[model samples]
Target: MNIWNLNLRHLRALTSIARLGSISAAAEAINLTQPAITQALAKLEIQLGQLLFERHANGMTATPAALLLAPRIERALAHIASQRVTMAQLRALIMLADHGSYATASTATALAQPSLHRAIGDLSVALKRELVDRRGKGIMLTDQGRRIVRTFRLARAELEAGLTELASLQGVETGRITVGAMPLARARLLPSAVSAFYRAYPDVRINIVEGSFQELIEPLRDGELDLMIGALRDPSPGADVLQQPLFADRPVVLGRVGHPLSLTSVTISDLALYPWTVPAPGAPLRVQWEKMFTDADVQLPNVPIECGSVITIRQILLESDFLTLLSPDQVAVELEAGWLTKIADTPEGLRRTIGITTRHGWRPTGMQNAFIQLLGEVAL
Candidate 1:
């Protein structure tokens, strides 16, 4: 169901009624007449196609639907933090924030430019804050505007999650899970888990967005992604994200199949006597690579290329005598095809923790939880 179709005020009334246990009390709390609150509940029930309350002489008791929806409504409202903002205004501002221009936002939403302008203007007045500022031919959100946009995105997620849960209770499997995947996870971990999950929940959609951690972290924080899978960072990425270690991946020194290092017992000095292609500085693999040279008291090798793409690195390794540090899983196909071979183990058995990262307090829908379980099973 499109959450935009439901009235925010009615949703508030539902939560209020559930909390207060009576229509008159809820009406008094929200400063509405009892009849108005009753009508709001009635409308909500009809829209949801579920009975929300059981009437009694003493008070109204919440039904299963209300019990399921009320907490989500409460949490969503808390994220919104204002009863004065309307859904139209929220939609307008979010579009403006995303698209960055009145004309562009109108084109994207099919909303009239004047309507979009009015909605944002009215919203700013209601919130007592200037949300957007004119800058040359374009516009930009003020800091306050950006904060509100993030909160609104989170609020929408909560409502959508509630709807997904409701659908599950009715034996309908639906909803989408957006995953942010870094290099190593994409190679094998993510694909294996996704294959198993798809077999069990064929109706659910999964979107895997591939990028480095730097490229994907903000989107994950903004509620655009359900989770990220990759090597964990030392000193956790931030207080807002939680990492779960699935397995320890010890990287190996890799080169072309007939490289000199592959034919003999390799030492750190022997490994350092060649040009290397490694991840950009500050990457987990790069840090480990640096530490290997540091421990050996050998000068770092001449790195002609700073790269993160395994496919490109593989091509470079196959065509030239270059070495790189990588998880064996990342190049499993090439290893099996004789296109690449392990030159040596990373010195001293240095290993990186491969894991899943998610919002610190995220509550996954049942389908999302099931997928996470599958990831753990595959890792084992």
Candidate 2:
């Protein structure tokens, strides 16, 4: 079905008819004639390739398709509305959301109360939903209105990014890249690439978000992250994102500079006697740490901390005798600074592919592509 034919008027007709249960009521709600509302519903059904409602003697009964499509239609309408909406209206909405009152929103936006009200009303009309409601002394966003606000924020970010890229094409190079950094990238890889990219394009803004796999994937899929850097997941990471291998890194046991394990030739069993700081259970590094003990017929060590932060883990290693298995790339700077040392060799065949994760079909802008190329240079 060609979605372009299904306009806001058609969507409004569908939602109103489903909610009010009659064409006449739907017409009155949207300020359209009964026949116009009826025609809109017919056109919507044709474009969607499904029946939305069944007509009865008394009124229209919503079909399963109608129920399924209502919320989606609302979201789609909101997204479309966000594009057509003016900056003043969006600014008014944001201020209204923050202040929770039309008077305060007007104060913040430096617009008159009626102007602020009109802006919000225009946006509400575009989205076909009431955005805010008055309570005792404050205003609140409706559930659908919250969704619109969230989507509009994302839209604003994308628009800003696009404008930044447009400026970059003229050789100005002022832009922002939001990177989702997994444990490995936070250590050395991202820092090195960021430094190099900054040297070349100092005007570019780089924001790194640190997270575990579970925490970062959704943001990557939602266009919130330009790309994710860290270990590649086996099998495909669903069909929404593409994983590109940049390098392979093996786990290395690390400790304080003069720790007991660093002085002696150590076996996995010999190292298992001490307290350890390992990755959280089910992490790629944690899985490899367990397998190391299994191969050597050793019991797992007492894990005082199952940490995911390389920064925190490095601090722990610096302050204590606890040992941990991690990718060497995660501690290159600390190792170079002589604060930590590699205590034991990783088990043979214990290696993970570190790579980049980006949404499928995502196209990088000029500066984004340049930063990605810089990552390739810094990666092993």
Which pairs clash inside model 1?
Answer: none
Backbone collision tally, model 1: 0
Q: Rate the local accuracy (lDDT) of all candidates.
A: 0.91, 0.78
Top-TM-score candidate index = 1
- List TM-score per model, in order: 0.96, 0.64
Tens-digit lDDT track of model 1 for 172-280: 9899999999999998889999999999999999999999999999888888898999999998989999999999998999999999889999999998899999999
Badly placed stretches (over 4 Å) of model 2 are: 1-154, 235-237, 295-298
Tens digits of per-residue lDDT, candidate 2, 96-167, equal 776778887777767899988898899888767888887777778998776666565544444455445435
Backbone-clash count (model 2) = 0
